[model samples]
Target: MNDEVAQQVVPRTRYHALFVVAILTGSFLLFLVQPMVARMALPRLGGAPAVWNSAMLVYQALLLGGYAYAHWLGRVPVRMQAGIHLAVLAVAAMWLPIGLTAMELPADAEPAFWVPWLFGASIGPLFFAISAQAPLLQRWYSVASGGRDPYALYAASNVGSFGGLIAYPLLVEPGLALRGQSLLWTIGYALVFLLVAGCATLLPRRVGGEPHVAHHSPAPGAGRVLHWVLLAFVPSGLMLATTTFLTTDIVAMPMLWVLPLGLYLLSFSFAFREGEALPAALTRIAPVLLLMFGSVLIAGDQQLAYVNALIGLLLLFLVAVALHSCMYRLRPAPDRLTGFYLAMSVGGALGGVFSGLIAPIVFDWTYEYPLLILAAGMLMPQAFLFDPIARLWRGSAQLLRIKTLAATLAIAVPLYLGLFNPGGLLGPMHEQVAFVGIAAIGLFSVGRRIPYLVALAGGLFLFGGYRAIETSLSGDRTRSYFGVYTVTDMPRERRLAHGTTLHGIQLKGARSRLPTTYYVPGSGVGQAMLAAPQLYGPAARIGVVGLGTGTLACYARPGQHWRFYEIDPAMVDLSRDSGKFSFLRQCAPQAEIIVGDARLRLAQTLPASLDLLALDAFSSDAVPMHLMTTEAFTTYARVLAPDGLLLVHISNRFLALSPVVAAAAARGGWHAARLVYTPSAPEKRDEAAISDWIALSRDPATLARLTGGQWQPLTPQRSFTPWTDDYASVVPVMRALNPSLADD
Candidate 1:
């Protein structure tokens, strides 16, 4: 009898392992292709950070479709479903070695629409086919394993997803080019086909068989499905918002993009596993973390930006795990598994749409980050840390009302002082005092839902949210598909900032015409601009790629033909027409401004039209990878005269980019010199920031002329590959060699 039971269990265990491997492989490929295809599209679409978000939306939408397909396939027999899925996998293989299609973006294309269209065209069929594998395979596992619970297999799926996301930047990207990455993914897809087929063979022989588990439970109601969706929504949206916040406001590191998403996928593993201790404990503590960390996240602490980024990530992970665990607790029997996942996919797609697509357009700042944090607070499971607190809440209706009132009043005192009377009555530490009071109230309100939500909302409003609201009300903040920009008027200067990076600042009075920030006379770009006439004679044609406050226009001499290429139309309005910065209107009023991507516009210009080409385009603090590629430099070379100086603003807070420029210069047969410009104390007081610029030219004499004094020879890394349209990764250049250089 014991041997009979052992023999039965052995086959079931083997079947389980086969299904797990198949789902894991499919999920890994599904996530691996996301970043791969996005990287492939960087050159054609431009590297605005929003491009990643748009790609995410396309993936999420496809995931929804895939889940829905799996749900609909349930009406068919198990054998038919397996056969159809295998056929779909074979059909999707035709798009193997995935890449962008031959579709060219229109000159006046809108990125919001164009990006999704391009990505969907490139990888839609393949992603759709593989996305359905997780749910479909789980269903097959239940049938094959004699009505065993299948939801635990989801943990394996998400573990594979996390691995794939982490591997792209750390392994595949640095080691392989685009073509190689595509081939590797194709091989993985082929492996998935075989593993899936092996799992299919384990299915029951009866064509119309249903799992015995299906007879034990009824179908879920409409409200239950909606509950699953709400549980899924907050975490999905919060993940994207956290990614944007970390990359935009915190340190912009090379692999920072994967951290939030990797954590999000890992949360599913923690949430869905058979073990309950970790998920339950995390859910219990989630409310307190939300109130404490969510408040501090919105407060914008640049001094502790890295610490804050970690906290934000921790907060996101906890929230996602808690909410996902709620979905797990509410999960129906094995019969409704596909429908459950379909609802989750719907919520995830809606969340991505709201945060990735809608928030950037509707709000000036990252309002979605706070809003989603609040939503997480509302959705996440809450339980008292102690039995006494639970008893106090469960005593009586009247007692509960009194306790809630006291909690609200306790939270309100600090909120009121922090909002209207900061430092007046509570002294200099008033903000700290308010934080403690709100945190205390939030702690006690846990497990009491309504009061805890009130505390969370209060925490959000007190910590930097009011300031964001003020900025929005004043019309000083502008949102574009690229990023958020804010203009501030100081005592003696007006400043322009893209996200947290200062773009340009203009002093009032006589110094208004003088260049400031990175374009000061002592900077490398400044030296190149000052020597424009001497290099190419009086009628030098100058083309500046980025038109930030048009500060470089001050270097334009009377006969110099200056044309500015700016991507954002809102930026043109601010620097040129909005009467904010007077650099363009005062200095180069007649300088033509062309509104479009600099690379695409530069590609259309006649050959040898410009004597000096300055490349300074930035999306927030990130240098668009496309502009730094060898192909982009080829276009710059085509548009510039033989002796033309190509000035690249390599000033960055997180990345050491001189090596990249040096590699490109070596490949293109150009002499390059780098200038590390540190201004004098007096210059610092006058808004002159430290800047790094690299000057390159095919003519050695021209580069020599530009780098005469402070410039030094480029130190090219022998192992660092030159970034080309075919492949580029920031891993080699992210040494943080000059962390003090302010963004240009």
Candidate 2:
């Protein structure tokens, strides 16, 4: 029987091209919808940092569902599987253009619950239908082509996924608005459907009196399956960690999310390709790369956003390739391919859940990042880079000495401070000399796991992890859905920081009543506050969105009604802690504080109630994409008095959002002007950094009165159109990096 089937088996050339095209197109459509739909949903759900994380969890869950369905389908005849999958695609198409449905989140809705529900309901069916094609098509190709190597095409599928991710940010998003991008995706889905049909045609037809082809390979054992899952989990979890660390702890550019994901997708191409050596070479050195980059990053400050981003992206790529190569090495035979992919998808989903959802709730810091890095070190295929190191590890006596030395060095945290302190005997270059010694000691333990881990620990501690440890010990840090906040006490003042940006700095007892940071008396918000009494009467009602240590609350006067819409409860707690920031307690103790997503909470508030509404809720460098939407602007207009000024803080390192706010203001038929505040020097303004605030009002006179000296008409580019909820793009607003604004 085996011999007869062997003779009848067809050459791979029969169906390879059709299967490749189907898989590539489906994979491309699968990844493209992720950023697109999230971008579309931004206005409805304020762009809290966790919005994307929640979206990723939804995508992974749907992907696991699709793969499981495909694995179950493998029990049926090839022709039947193809027909059923085609039917699934046809049904999913009813959700064309992949736009979100009109769903309003209540002011009290928990984003952790609402985000997944919204995304799952909007694009769940379509994403699932497409996500199944990669593994399902490969299974079909295996049987249709008579047991050829279909696994290599998995590499091709990932190549297409990487292309789609790259194209969306650099090519697709920059040129096309949300509407056009959706339309283009719909067209691509149609093409992919047609391609799936073409692949079906290549399947051998079922004939009467013929048994269905049963091509079963050796089933993998439980241990081997578990190994496959572990390999897939590390890289998947690390990708999410790298993304969160970059956008949350560093800069929150929408496009930067794709870079890690794209590199992750590309790692599959490197791993699964036949006879490839670049991946193997990278696997050999990936641990060292992780050690170097991870250590530097943990010790590294926020001053080098660009440099840190570059290092972070490269580290993610290398780790992904090395770990994915392990998966490629352990992949099952063609007949067992569906189960293999199912396990891999399960691992990926669990990883996403762990880092994206569980980590925030479970820990006060991004501890998952370090734990995942250590797991990568344990799981990735390692080899002796140098013969001497290999010989040392192979010999027990020498290995013990090496381990002892690593242990000794790992605990020597103060040795670095004591000898290499910049102010100590070694001078300014001592820090560099210390890191070099640490790196050299780390290099000696290349192949041995215990010693290598010791080195990783020593380097990580010496560099970045120390600050986190200090913050943790101090009990001044709090992690929430929005991000992490750290409160530090300086001799002159108490400072609250949300990620790298200072949320507020309150001077010690005597000066605690004064606003600091972006709210200093000379800044844009400061100018608005200084004019509040003259612009509105003493009875004016003031509303502030983003209660960052309640610094703006200090602007309150007697008889003025004030309220704050703060998204994170942690922020509200810290602001009112009095022990941390006294701006609210000292100035406006009775101020009403609403805890929920700002826009949703604002919508619930009475309309046209406030004399002025300040949109100062920024998570570090991120301008909540949702808050800047045209619908959000309309919401602000409805809530503000006819002559009220809508103040938007637009100071950013990456995006020139003055244009975005100006454009939205124009679309709302409001007059807009901007105030650019540069403190000149740190000492001159009591640590108040530069800030650019745009003022919008329906009344021309209100805007005119606010413009002069520091205030000027915001110049909106002629071709720029305001971003509405249904259609908004940030690509054009991305500012060119200049020397002065390098670290903004």
Candidate 3:
């Protein structure tokens, strides 16, 4: 009897190990493909960012489909479940070595529609097969192990998810190119298939076509299921909202994209498994943090970027873990695991759609970030930390609720006064002091929902809500496919800003017709446009990629047909309409403006047409990746006359794009020169901000003319990999971004 028991124990242990390994490998590979395929598509899609959001929608839909498929397989026998999954894997293999198919988006294509369609058609089958592995394998383990707890294995799956997310940025991307990453993922997929097959063999056989039965739990009610969905929804939406906030100019690279998502995945592990004590404690204090940081973050442009970034990340981690914990706490029985996960997937998909697709269209700013943060606060499981607090809640609960509302009013009134009472008794310092006091009062009601929300609403209103509400009331903000833009009216200037970066600044009245900001006479594009009549004759056909207030429109002359390629329709409206900036209306009323992605639109224009084409498009933070690639330069080359100049605005806060342009120019067989325009205090009139422009041309005479006076010959960073449609790495650019860091 001892020997029989020992043999049986060995197989059980082996099969459980196989199940664990299968779940981990499948989840890891599943997340690994998401960013990999996105990186591959970056150059083709440009840095519009809506592309990534749209891609996320496709991923969520496939995940829901996979989870539903897994739920359906529950009715089948264990062996047949194994057979069907294996066959599905075999079929999905046809689309392996996963990469996007070669299909260029048409000029008029709606990215919100096309991006999802493209990704769905390309990787949908493979993702569907792999995504089903976690919940499906966990169910198989329950049957095989005589109904052992399968929930703990979910922790393993998320650990694998965290691993995959971190590894893509830290290991796989740095060590290997896209081709290598794709190949490695293929190997990992094969390993997952074998492990899953091994796990299938451990199931106890009931013999010839018999129904394999186990302890089935009772069905969950609609309310209980709805609770699961709502719990999952807040965290998922907040994760995407945080990503959208962080990536815009804070750190506009692919690696930073993983931070919010990586934390979100790791939250599941802690929320589900043995490390419950730590998450529970943090969750209790999460409300306080949300009240303090949530409003200030949404207010934005505080100038303490690093501190805000850290606080923002912390806020996301706390809420995500806490909300996910609610999910783990309310999880249904093992027999109902598939249904539970299906609800989770549904919630996740809905969240993605709201943040990624709907919010950008509906709101003029990232209003979703604050709204989701507030939702996270409301949804997170709450309880008083101390017994005294609990007694207070029970005894004076009704009084406390009313008092909480009054307390919120009191806090809000003082905060409102402080923000608006410029100079004398209350200033910025007084505002900070009021916030400190609010923070202290907020800490007392750590787990009480009403008091906490009062504090939260007050804090939000105090920190940035006052300003945001004021801006909203004025109705000067415009939200677009790219990001939110604030058209701030100043005494001297009317500025167009995307986030913290000023896109264009037009001086009021008569000064508006003058080219200002980065387009002043001393700037490279400024100098090039000044010399256009002599360089390409009086009938100069000029092209500009980015039209910010149509500042360059001031340079247009008679018989000069100027064309502007602007990606955002909002920009076109603001820059051209006589009611807005008036640079285009007053100076170049006849200028033809094309509204679409500059790269795609430029390709559709007449070939060999322009004297000078200035590439100045902005996606708020960084230059559109698609615009600086070799292919993009080739498109520009095709549209220019033999000696026509190509002027690229390379000035950026977070990126060193001079090298990128130099490499692109080198690859396209053109001489290049860079003019780094740094304005002195005296030369700062008419909004002449700092600028950097790269001039590239195939003709020696044109390059000589552009470089003769102030421009210096551009040098390519030989060690830096040139950006192509297939590959571009931001690490080197990041390192060279600062003088101090470059030496290290």
Candidate 4:
């Protein structure tokens, strides 16, 4: 009997190991392909960030589908379940040697809708099959192992997810081109299939111990199922919300989005790993950190963009660990794993709706981020000791429902008056008021529901509401597809901005392609435009893509033909019609401004007619990924005459765009040179100053002519790497620049 028990344990142990390996490999492949395929399509689709958001939505939806399918499969017998999944795997393989289909992007179509649909159709089936493996296979492992604690495999699953995400930007993308990435992924898929087949051979012949019987059903009751859904939803949605808030010029960078997601996935591993305690102490303090960090992280006016981002991510993970641990404590038995995961999928999808879809339309800003943070604070477990009043009240049965509403009201009065009510006695001391409010709320929330509400209110007021009200009342904000552009009206006519590389200022109203702020009368763009009459004649064919208050329109001359390719209609209206600035109507009233994506509009214009094409659309944080690629430059080259100039506004807060410009220029066989425009203090009129501009041209004469006497000959930095469609790394580029030089 002892020998038989040992033999039985051996096969089960080996099969458990195999199951872990298979799910991990599958998850790794699943996440790896997301960024890989997206990077491959950058050149083709024109790197609009909306493309990325759309792609992510497709992924979330498909993930939900996969979970739903897994839950449904639990009704079948063991052999039937294994056979059906195997058949599904074989059928999905038809998309093998997988790559995007030959169907090209429509020249005039919007990428926001099309990119998701196209990519979804191409890889949806394959991804769905692989995604389903985690939940379904884990359940099978449980049955095969005779009710063993197999849930630890979930942590292994997320480890693969983190590995896949980290490896792509670090190893896979930098190492392989698009074609190579696709082929490698296909190979990984094949290996997963074979491994899964191997594991399938180990699945028990019976539901429990009866050979050839059907799978066992879950325990009766809806309350049990509801717990699974809530546990899954909060973490999934919060993960995405963190991505949106952090990645936007808030802490804007390409790979920065991965950090929040990577950490979120890793939390699952920590919570689910076998023998791990999910640490009582860490979870105990998670709410305190979430409240403290979550409040100040959102509210302060300090330019600690990177630091704020770090705090935000840490708070998210800590809160996630706490919430996930709670779920782990309440996790149903192994037979209900698939159902549990399905509930999680439903929550994940709802989170996407809140952050990606509903938030954009509902809030004028990304308020959803802070709203979700408050939600997390509410839903996440609080320590009984931390809520000492509650603990005390619970100790006395009579006080359970009626403890301390009077004390709460008295404390809340001073807090609300001091923090939220503007111009209260504590008016001059805002930060002090906010700090007091946070502390008061934290203590008050101890024994009752009212305290949680107070904490949430205090959090919102301290973190977001205060700043938003100030920004709104100031009337110094701009919203474009790229990001929010705010030009604050400051003392001495100097405007401070938070997003975008360049801020063009005209004396409230000025005209003549003359420059202001970054493009001062003495700057390179100013000098180039001033010389347009001599360089390309009064009939100069000029083109400007980003029309920021139409400041460049002031540089235009009579009879000079000018064209503007603007994507956002809101910006066009603000620049041309809004009384805020009159640069366009005064100097270039007759200039044609086309609305749509600049690249698409540029493609429609007559070739070789433009004398100078100034790619100066740095209005906000987003770097319209479509505008600075080899293909984009080639299109510009085609539109300009032989010696025509291409002046790119390469100035960026979060990115060093010179390399991308240089790479595109190189690919197009054009000579490019950068002009680092640093305005002297004496030149600083009451305008937003500091800007960097780079000029690229195919003709030596145009390059020479633009740089002639106005700016120094720029030596092309050899350290700069060329950005390609399939692979573009920004870490080196960002590291070379300083973040503090902006005219704040």
Candidate 5:
């Protein structure tokens, strides 16, 4: 009897281990492919972060379809299901060594619709095949192990997902080019297939074609399924929203995208694991964290950005784990595991659509972030921290109503103070007083859902949401596919901002025509523009890649032919057509404006048609990675005259980009010089901001003209790799991530 028991235990353990390995490999590849394919498509798609968000939507949709297919397969016999899935895997292998399709982007293609079509066509089959493996394999495990619990396997699955996500940015991206990365992923995929095949062999064979293992538990009702979905929905949407809020409004740090997603995936590991201590504790504290940190997030304090970013990530992780734990507790029998995952997938897809696709179009600011926080409050499990607080809430219906009304009244005071006395006219102490009042009220309201929600909403409003609402109501903000743009009227200047990065500033009245900000007369681009007529004559054909307030248009001579390549049409409207700034209208009214991605548009221009070109395109503070690659420089070389000058604006708060430009110059056999211009005390008074720019040219003499006073020869860093369309990683360039490289 002991030997029989021991033999059964040994095979069961081996089978469990096989399924774990299979699920892990499949999930790792599933996430690894996401960033790889997006990187490959950068040259064709342009480098707006929105492009990444759109790609995430496609991934979510495919994941939904994959889960649905897995659920449907459960109706068939277990052994037959395995055969069908293996065949599906074989068919998907046809798309191995994945890459973007050969379809050309049409000139008038809309990114919202076009991006999905391109990515969907490129990796749809492979992603679908890999995505189905986790749920499918877990179901197989239940049957093969004689109905042992399979939910623990889900924890292992998410652990693999988190590994893949972190590895792409840290390991795979820095070490390999696109071709090598694709090959590596292909090898991984082949390994996945073998692992899956091994797991399938352990399944019991029945000649009668018996139905899948049955659970005695009843099927979940419609309401229960919807409850599972809502619990899943808020976290998925909040993940995207938190990412956007951190990078755009808080700080545009490289690899910041990984944190929210990594934590989100890690939360699943903790939520579904067998141990209850960690997730239970996190859920118990989540509501308090949401109330406190959610308010701080909306406060918009730039001075404390890094600290705030950390707090925001903590808030997102806690909320996600807490909500996901609720779903785990309500999980059905192993027989219904695939169905549960299908419903969760549907919620995830819907959440992605709302946050990634719909919210940007509907709200000028990041309203979805706060709104999702409110949704999380409604869904996350809550309990009193102490017994007395619970008794007060559980006493009577009349008492509950009175306490709720009192909480609402207490919250109203801070809201009114924030809205009316935004400048703290009530006193320097007013803001602190309001903060304490709201915190106290919010703490008392805990354990009661209605009162707690009221407190959370009040905190959101009182901190910084009122200001966002004010900006939106004033019609000064506009949101597009790229991002939000705001026009702020300052005392002496009118400024256009993309997120926290100032794009352009036009001084009032007589100075409106002068190039201010980074285009001040002493800047490198300024020196190049001032000397254009002397070098190329008055008929100099100049092309500018970015048209911020059309500031460079002021450098156009009477007979000089000028053109501006701008990606966002809304920028053209704000700078030229809206009469917001007169730089284009007053200086170069007839300058040609070409609206499209700078790289694609420049590729279409006649070779050697321009005497000089300036590359100044930016999405918020981030320069598009594609625009800085070696292949992009080849396009720039093709478009400019043999001796024509190229000016690149390298001024950025978070990245040390001079090395990248220097390396590109070295690889392409071009002479390069960099100028670091710090505005004089007088220039600062006149709105001349400090700027860094690099000038490169094929002819040494052309670059020599600008190398004397402020310009110095650009030295290539031995440690830095020149970016190419096939390979680039921002990890080494980020100032916060690489403190040793900050001074570079």
Candidate 6:
């Protein structure tokens, strides 16, 4: 290996520079392609958060498969390895020039079961091959550069991932149409294929004429593999837990999932950085921070979005750095890099499954979060500064045991009160006091493991588990595809809620159907439904999308036909059952109720039948991406009578939905006006606030009549960017929030 030739193959050389460049480019291209394709599917799949969750599951499964295949090929000779992988890549390209199939989702199928089926049928194989790129290419970089630190390349990989994530919301989505985005991804994939081939050429044919196949060895033992699984499991579940806590209780908005996942990936960059390592001291402080912050996390709804997000992310980073640093310490030598990654891949996949799948089924609530926090506490490595104090604590001597027992009693008394005594022990001020006491005790037990374990148990019992149990015991709770709906029964009425925001409310036994809370008679949907008879004559056909305690059912009049398209079967059952609010039974008992996704069901309706359509289908904070697409508006226009009205509900604490509706109305040649509802009082029974609703129609008369009554123009939001099917932005809406926006 002469100087000039070595330079050609080495880190700073022309060839080596291109090698690094190609790997980073391929990773960027690969990650960018994921969101692009998933966004394309939104128009067809409808904007159920389940759609994105399903797509991510498919990607995780394929990624694990790819890593496993890479591990297997490490046993093959270098040339044969390249040959096989190239052949695999070629086969994957057969399905490319990517676009979703023309197949429609089944009208009757459950979204939980069908979304995975849909994504798997569409692009599983291509994603699997592309997902294998990072690990395999990193190994090749190690081999090509004679085992130089290739770990820095991983930082480049996540940087690309973050770039892709940011680009979807900022650039690719809002800028290009779906068709254009697909073609661009296809071109990038082609470039990646070429790059992989070029990278293969740089691999050493045989090191000193010895086979590269003989360099690696068998898989790790079960104990070592389980250690990897536990380390990976904590961060992954905690990420999802953070998402649930933030969105469900703290804030509900579109695209909030991105931040937690973004931070999770960023932590990996720090964990694996080779040259600049996380110090041992930082690792030691992390557990204490975890114990401290973990209690604060479950300290009831912070409602402080930025503050809570900052604290949650900081806690995740500290724990992730501590745990992943452990994984880094356990990392095998460069020769076993591929096998080491295979174990990690297994752990990553398992963690996702536990958090996404098993947790949802096994626990009625989001219990996986607290459980994972405990797991992180168990796995975190700790050491004590005072050896004598630690020995006295662990020993079973009579006086020492009595002192230990007294310390245990001191922690338990307050913890029991905090956890079991409702507002007594874990009250507002007591939470912090209990946490400080626990942290002080945890300091004494650091290196010994059991003290930290007790502290973690004490913290969870005081913070997370008790509240979770409280929310669980009250039958006021309801879980559906939309999210957790808690039915709050008041003195005069009962309210249907999605998180803290009330969807609909009905008086104890009212005769006339009056719009309650955000659905004031003067609001957008209210005005449209109120004017339905005048616009379409006495026999006007009305279609209400989404059934929330059947509140809209009360607007029906004699000789007027009405229908409701509801997605959740649970909602349908609740609305009709005698125990719940009987708006349908009391108001429009004869109205037809079609079950399934409203957009899909709407496609089956007779053309020009509906004189008025009101879209009120919001599942928690999830903006059904499919409903706001240009094609969806077209469907609404097709079924509606020429002079009909369309009313969309946009009252959300998180997303500014009016701009998206305005964008659709503009694209579809319909006139649109928004009505912002502000109630006279903040706590005056949720049924009294004005619902932020937008009304649109092709007929000037319909729009005029609907706006004739107390309708006010919603101040046009300059910061609100129109969200399209091809691309959407949540930043504008999130930024528009005033500091004083109080959580209900």
- Winner by TM-score: 5
Per-model TM values vs. the true structure: 0.95, 0.92, 0.92, 0.90, 0.95, 0.88
lDDT of 5 at 712: 88
Query: Judged by TM-score relative to the true structure, which candidate is superior, 1 or 6?
Result: 1
Q: How would you encode candidate 2's per-residue C-alpha lDDT over 1-744 as one tens digit per residue? A: 255545544566767777888888889888788888888876677666567777877898899999999988877877788889999999999988779888877766666798899998899999999999989999778666766678888888998898888877778876787889989999999999999998888776642223333544578899999888888888889898888788767666756777888889988988888886888888888988987777777544678877888888888888889888888888887777889999999888888888888988887777778778888887877677788776765647876787667555663654366244845765666555566666666677667676667667666666657768778888999888677788888888887776666677888867778777787888877877778888998988899988888888889999899999987778888888635777788899999998767887788778889988899877777667778888899999999989998889988767777767877877788888888888766444556777888888899998787678878887666777777766666677666633432432
> Which scores better on TM-score, 1 or 4?
1
> Would you list the rank order by lDDT, best first?
5, 1, 2, 3, 6, 4
Better model by TM-score: candidate 5 vs candidate 6: 5
Clashing residue pairs in candidate 1 are: none
True-vs-predicted CA distance for residue 327, candidate 2, Å: 1.0
Model 6 earns a TM-score of 0.88
What global local distance difference test value does model 4 have?
0.72
Model 6 lDDT tens row, 1-744? 445435445454634665666666666766776787777776666665566677778778778888888887766665677788889889988877776766766655565677667666667777777777777777778767876766567667777777777777777766677778778778877887888888888876654323555654464678987898788878887887778766775567677777887777777777777653463666778777777777667654546656766777788777777787788777776667777777777777778777776665566566777788788888877766577866766655686657655666667765655545565655667766666777677666666565567777788777656766776797666565355666777888877766555567887755336767656665667667777777778998999888878887777888999898887666776788645777787778899988767787888788998988899887665777778767789999999988888888877766656667777787788887777766655446555764678888898766877785456554344544555665565554553553323331
What lDDT tens digits, residue by residue, belong to model 5 across residues 1-744? 134323433267689788998999899998899989999988888765467777887898899989999999988888899999999999988987788889978866666788899999999999999999999999888877767789989988999999999999999999999999999999999999999999888876642224654546789999999998998889999998998888778887767889999999999999998988999999999999998888878786889988999999999999999989999999999889999999999888888889888998899988999999999998988888788877777757787789788887878887678556676666766655676778777887778788789889888877778789999999898877666788999888998878776778888888778898899889999999999988898899999998878888988889999999988777888888888878988999999999888887888889999989999986667668899999999999999999999999988878889889989999998899989898887675447888899999999998887678878889899989999999998878888788987776
List ranges where model 5 is wrong by over 4 Å: 1-10, 48-50, 104-114, 207-209, 213-215, 421-426, 737-740
Lowest lDDT 10-mer window, candidate 5?
Answer: 1-10
Minimal lDDT window, size 10, model 1: 1-10
Give one clash count per candidate, in the order shown. 0, 3, 0, 11, 0, 10
* lDDT (Cα) of model 2: 0.79
Candidate 6 residue 346 Cα shift, in angstroms, is 1.8
TM-score ranking, best first:
5, 1, 3, 2, 4, 6
Q: In model 2, which regions exceed 4 Å deviation?
A: 1-14, 103-107, 206-215, 251-254, 395-438, 680-686, 737-744
* lDDT for position 225 in model 3: 91
After aligning candidate 6 to the native by TM-score, how far in Å is the CA of 689 from where it should be? 1.4
